[model samples]
Target: MSKTHFPLPVRQLAVFLSLLFSGYLLSCTASEAQSDTPPLNPNGDSELALLMRAMFDDAQAMKQQIKEGKTPRPSLDYEKILTAEATEPDKAASDTYKVHALSYLQTIKALQQADAAQAASLYENMVNSCMGCHKALCPGPTMRIKKLY
Candidate 1:
């Protein structure tokens, strides 16, 4: 015996398409979310200090990688620190804080792209961004940001 298949109803097809579209959107959002680094704590002294130290450490490591002609390992800890900072409670100026972290990440990406001069330029901007944030949120790190150069 032969079997016949019927076409799906238009409403069902629309629903399926809607679900597929939603899934696609969500996947894109998830990937973007994964790429973002969290903000550092704007208030915790120890946490801010640690993150500031990590930022310098990561910068040094990136420099060392360039000097040794090796690919730098990504700093996963920095991302976590930034995430925590970005999500901290009572963050009235969180948007500005996030901009600083993002600037540093952008500079790092430029460094990874192999343009030494452009990367160097971005490095100063990155330091500036950090300084700008630290000046208000964690003043103690102002000197540390200067040392990163």
Candidate 2:
């Protein structure tokens, strides 16, 4: 056929494959950059650990409100817990734990601000932080954290 060109569909497929491969390469590069970072331990019981624990406690209390058929208190004061954790992040088991602890505190605050449906969504994130940390440095409390969900 004297080198007849490929069809338009083949060109589109080639473009799509190229884009997909590029995305995968970028993701792999980003993941590799984070691979050397240390894991978190949310249950270490240091200051950050304590803050994470307190955050979880607050989350549980909110859940209890639902169970008891009561509204969550609007003045739960999540900032206090966050401030305490931020003030001394180095005391946490790891930097990742400190970061996640702070994030969990904010999530609790958001839950308080959100409607019941939104609050329920935040609950999953709270549990995820616990599981993420426990999977690395401290698996001891992972079971209890799972129960919270």
Candidate 3:
């Protein structure tokens, strides 16, 4: 028999990355709120609708876990927002979306790093970023996203 094992941190990073990707897929598939015809934005990228639903699903799950007094492990792959082909290429390249997305990402990072007492407020700010972006680009999902809080 041959046996090989990765170092602890490497293994942990692998598991975390796996969870981040799987969370996206699971979130998409598990969401019952998704409509058959996704609401496309002005740029006409319907693919982003599914991604948004997946994110919403993930956010809902995280909020639920926190409400249950559990520290939900961070599962976002910030790189996906940068690289995902489903998004509008031009919008991805836009400084406006990038700034809003970065704020959301930073809030998530803060929540991930925060102690329990601070997580709730950080989570609210994270959701606020979602609202801010939606208000500017895709207002249709604003109410749905707001419910994540």
Candidate 4:
């Protein structure tokens, strides 16, 4: 039998290199999996948070349709915005939040009925109501919601 032995330093270097390469690969994988979707709340997402994400996705599609001079379709039953559970119950249960939620629904209804020409204006109003509610209850989302415009 013939045996070939690597020097101790050479073996240690190989181990270190293997670990370094593994770390780099893992980091790349993690970065690739990252998405534009917002991170979940520390306490996990509430029903309202998930609905808002669906709303945002729908709004993006609607905005594209509007840009192409097509009518924006409302796919979500948005009345849930008023009753959906919130990550923070204290904030969502407030009278102010209720008012904002109602106003948002009104704007959404108006936008849904808008003609092609009026869709843009009504859409803007709808987005404004969203921002307004965010501003009143949680300002963190106002910036993200602005991208809807």
**TM-score of every prediction relative to native:** 0.49, 0.48, 0.63, 0.72
Question: What are the per-residue Cα lDDT tens digits for candidate 1 across 31-146?
Answer: 98789764454454455456657777887776566456565544645554455533234452477666766766665565556455455555566566667767766676577567
| Top candidate when judged by lDDT against the true structure | 4
lDDT of 2 by residue, 1-149 (tens): 63597788898999999999999999999998788554454333455456557656766786787566565553445555445543235534467766765776666566567766566666677677667756755676787687778
Candidate 4 yields a Cα-based lDDT of: 0.89
lDDT of each: 0.63, 0.64, 0.75, 0.89
Order of models, best TM-score first:
4, 3, 1, 2
Candidate 3 lDDT: 0.75
Shift in Å, residue 64, candidate 3: 0.7
State the lDDT of candidate 4 residue by residue for 1-149, as single tens digits: 22488888899999999999999999988886684454567677899999999999998888998999999998998999878999998888999999999998998888888889999988888889888888887998888998999
Is 2 or 3 the stronger prediction by TM-score?
Answer: 3
Candidate number of the best TM-score: 4
* Model 3, span 30-149: residue lDDT tens: 684464555455456555556666778878887887898777656856546645654556866677878887887888788789776777777788789889878876677787887888
- Superposed Cα RMSD, model 4: 7.3
Runs off by more than 4 Å, candidate 3: 1-47
| TM-score: model 2 vs. ground truth | 0.48
Residue ranges of candidate 4 with Cα displaced over 4 Å: 1-39
lDDT-superior candidate, 1 or 3: 3
The ten-residue window of minimal lDDT in model 2 covers 84-93
